[model samples]
Target: MPWINDAFWQQLAIGIAGGLLGIIGALLAAQLSSRGKPKKELSYDLRIERALPEIGKELAPHVAIRYKDRPVPALYVVTCKVENTGNTVVKGQQIRFDLTPAHPVLETYFAPKPEPEWEIEELPETEETPGPNYRFGHLAPGRKITIKIILAAPEEPKVEVRDFNPTEHVPVLPRTSTARANVQVRARIAVALLLALLVIPQAFYALGSVGDIAAPVVQLGLVAALAPFAPSLIRALVHLLFRPAPRINLDRGIVMYDGEIRGVINFSGEPADVPDSAQTLE
Candidate 1:
């Protein structure tokens, strides 16, 4: 009964007020730090050139051209040249490149392909012309591979190359679509970590002042609830901010040119006038 005196009640009230204030302070710090220091925007330079019209016939054998596995209104070819430009005996290094078309075209070309296991549905006609085939394997350091991609004109075509370093799952440069997503996700993670640092100490302090175990339990519960969602929240934000491109699935078959010079090719078949021209894009 003596321990339940007015002094004891006053102390308990003070502790509760302190705990609430501590939580608010911690949350504010987290939010401010999470905003992060402003940074200068990075600029990436990319260049695409149209393949020169003429090349020596002898060079044609070295240059390989193939239709993209998809159909298109215009005729396009992708050419690659690999050379060991370095004097060192380069080995074990592989070269990979991905070309993403510009906005409307990319959206159209990358329309998601149907899932095969799902209910059968008629496939949509491919609206993309053939381009050079993609290659994966090691290339020497001094070696350079030039890919020539030709497509039937829909105004002008732009291509971007994403390079993968030997040691990473993701490439160094962000593709136009994924860059903003990554930035938002990183910010969310930073915020979550900062919050954890601030909340944990205050939580321990509250637990010590009052032998009440519930204080610590509630603090831990808040952390647990917020931790897993940080990543998902960032992803959702990206989805809301920028709509991703549609997926396109391509089937094997030649979209033969029927000599008409101006029409869509749907069936798979060999391309007419398979050029033996020696034109290197390197």
Candidate 2:
């Protein structure tokens, strides 16, 4: 039998630490879909449906935008998706959307064409709130509503939820960059491959007739060898397939075009990660 050097033991220790972190990541992902009754929360996601430059160089060539014969700036469409992520039903009085900058709303409608009963009222700006607020009706558990707003503002407006005794708001966040994701995938493959190299032969030795170790020790060794390898392989697939896409920071503002997010600019004009390729839209 070949024994590993102390250096190998140190490397194994690092792998063990990494395995623990992978377990933690799995647990946090599970919480996103949890419908625990004890919690009171609303989850929201924003997507830019349409964005075009009103004063871009390309539009300067005899192109005019008018609605009903009246000139208008290039309209920006944004969809705000609010979901009742808790087990308890949420009433109309408990939730509202607080929008910023008091942007002029040209058209407000629901996607998929809603029923007559589905209605929301926009409250006028108040002394306390700098912008307008949209009040919604009752929302049942696991129910969601997607409201599309056509804004006259040059960019998408930031939205905030209020007045609900809500504990938290879950927003979609950016995922790993392409370069980072490739590195992670390769690392996972290497770990799983190396673990298989050790596990398969040990498993064969435990089951084969030439095995000299006691049955109980062999069984324990098999369990120890298989535990780390399974999760490492499974996490590789999860990271590859279900990794969240890079999303706009709704608190600042979203700038998207042709179903692709160009950049998310904040009040300070500082932008977050903007992709240099077609993947930037994601």
Candidate 3:
């Protein structure tokens, strides 16, 4: 009865109530932040080139001809066209093209075949994606341009359009949804820690009681105080262990409109005519 005195029970009850209030406060704060207006918005209009032969808008790969004795694996004149559809001008923009071949023979054929008006830069090769990155400094609204790259492979090559500065046209997210997401992540961590705090010591007490190492009255008081939060503790454990994966849907047509193009090799062949051409875009 000494361990179950009035002061002991009173303190335990206050601790449990304070923890519950803390959880409720964190949840309310998260909900309010989500409903608040976003702090910054990124909006810009750009489109990649696609086939419209009638209007002369296309992303076509033309095969170069080989005369009788001329041996060529396969040579394609890969053309990428990008246009500005938004009202604002895009400045200091660079387009990154990624080339990955299913066949190793095609690796030797990828090179920047730039047009006179365009400037090109060759990016250092990486193990995962080895190709050149072409820079287009500025694009005026409604202005379109074509970038031609020479690809010599045994099969049809694939190209990708990326590295445009669309954010240059819209406000950057200094703080807003990003802050909210960070706060939410902290809340989850807090909840997990609180549950572990509540459960682990009580579990030790239970084991102690079974082994005759704990006084009965003290154990009873702790159990009564913690019983109400058992369901919440279980839920916290489940969420911590089994969170869902984030989903992303990328549509090349929508993401790279205004002349960004991505290409992949669809055909296969030997490395016989693979061109040893690797040049930096100037």
Candidate 4:
């Protein structure tokens, strides 16, 4: 009967409620801060997806695709993709693709359409400027426009961006298809909300509204609930900050991190182990 007293039940409730409320509070705080400052990462990629001459290699110069009764020689089908790979929305960005050396471009098509109020202008080649500039405006976060071009030139188009600053220089990985990120974003928000609801009582008590005796019990209960997640959180921070970065040494033709080589290698005419003294790129 002593264990079943009103005080005992009260403590139990307070402890459980407090732990939950604390977790909620912490998650909410983190979510707010994670919104982060304004950042812009404009990533541009140019790839020749296909190159079919249609004619023999000796007569390849005559390969052509007709556009409205006009014969346009087809050398390659190049895809130019521009993506806003940053968190904050970037506006008024000027992206220019220059096709130099007087190449013949038959068509420029915008795949998947584009975001609203976007414009693409054609800058004709002048006596002063040799290349034709295709200028685009206003692309938002996670939105990308892929321009597919039917061309009659061997050289790739040069890309230039203006009126925006890149947050960082992150090298774009080569992929046959675009990789989608930040999936199911709503799930994270939902978890944060659920955690906040659990710690409401502790929040009120800590705000100086609850009794002296109940305060410590509630606080401890909340701390106990959140304790299990501490290790994983710490581990994540550690891995993010101190993780080793591996690089491929082209000269030695090996993959290594901090002078330590990883995995096996197959060099056609070279030896199994490259001399460490042969070259050191640190």
TM-score of each: 0.29, 0.42, 0.29, 0.50
- Better by TM-score, candidate 4 or 2: 4
Best by TM-score: 4
Q: How well does candidate 1 score on lDDT at residue 48?
A: 46
lDDT of 1 by residue, 47-110 (tens): 4443344435798556543334553334434343434332233333333334455322221221
Please identify model 1 stretches exceeding 4 Å from their true place: 1-9, 40-156, 160-203, 206-225, 228-282
- After superposition, the stretches of candidate 4 with alpha carbons farther than 4 Å from their true spots are 1-9, 51-54, 58-68, 118-137, 154-282
Q: CA lDDT of 120 in candidate 1?
A: 18
lDDT (Cα, tens digit) per residue for candidate 3, span 214-242? 22333344444445545555555675578
| Model 4 TM-score, all chains together | 0.50
**On a 0 to 1 TM-score scale, where does candidate 1 land against the true structure?**
0.29
lDDT string for model 4 (246-282, tens) is 5555355654446436577665765466677745544
Model 3 segments beyond 4 Å from truth? 1-71, 102-129, 164-282
lDDT of 2: 0.52
Model 1 lDDT on a 0 to 1 scale: 0.43
Model 2 lDDT, residue 232, Cα: 47
* lDDT string, candidate 2, 1-282, tens digits: 256777666655554444444334333333332322354345666665446655678756678776556556566676777666545655553344456766666776666654445455556656675443555555566776677777666566676655533343432222233334334544454454445445544543554332322233434444454454456456666766886666433333354434334556455655566454533333
Model 4: how far residue 190 lies from native, Å: 18
- Ordered by lDDT, highest first, the candidates read 4, 2, 3, 1
lDDT of each: 0.43, 0.52, 0.45, 0.54
Total backbone collisions for each predicted model: 34, 0, 21, 8
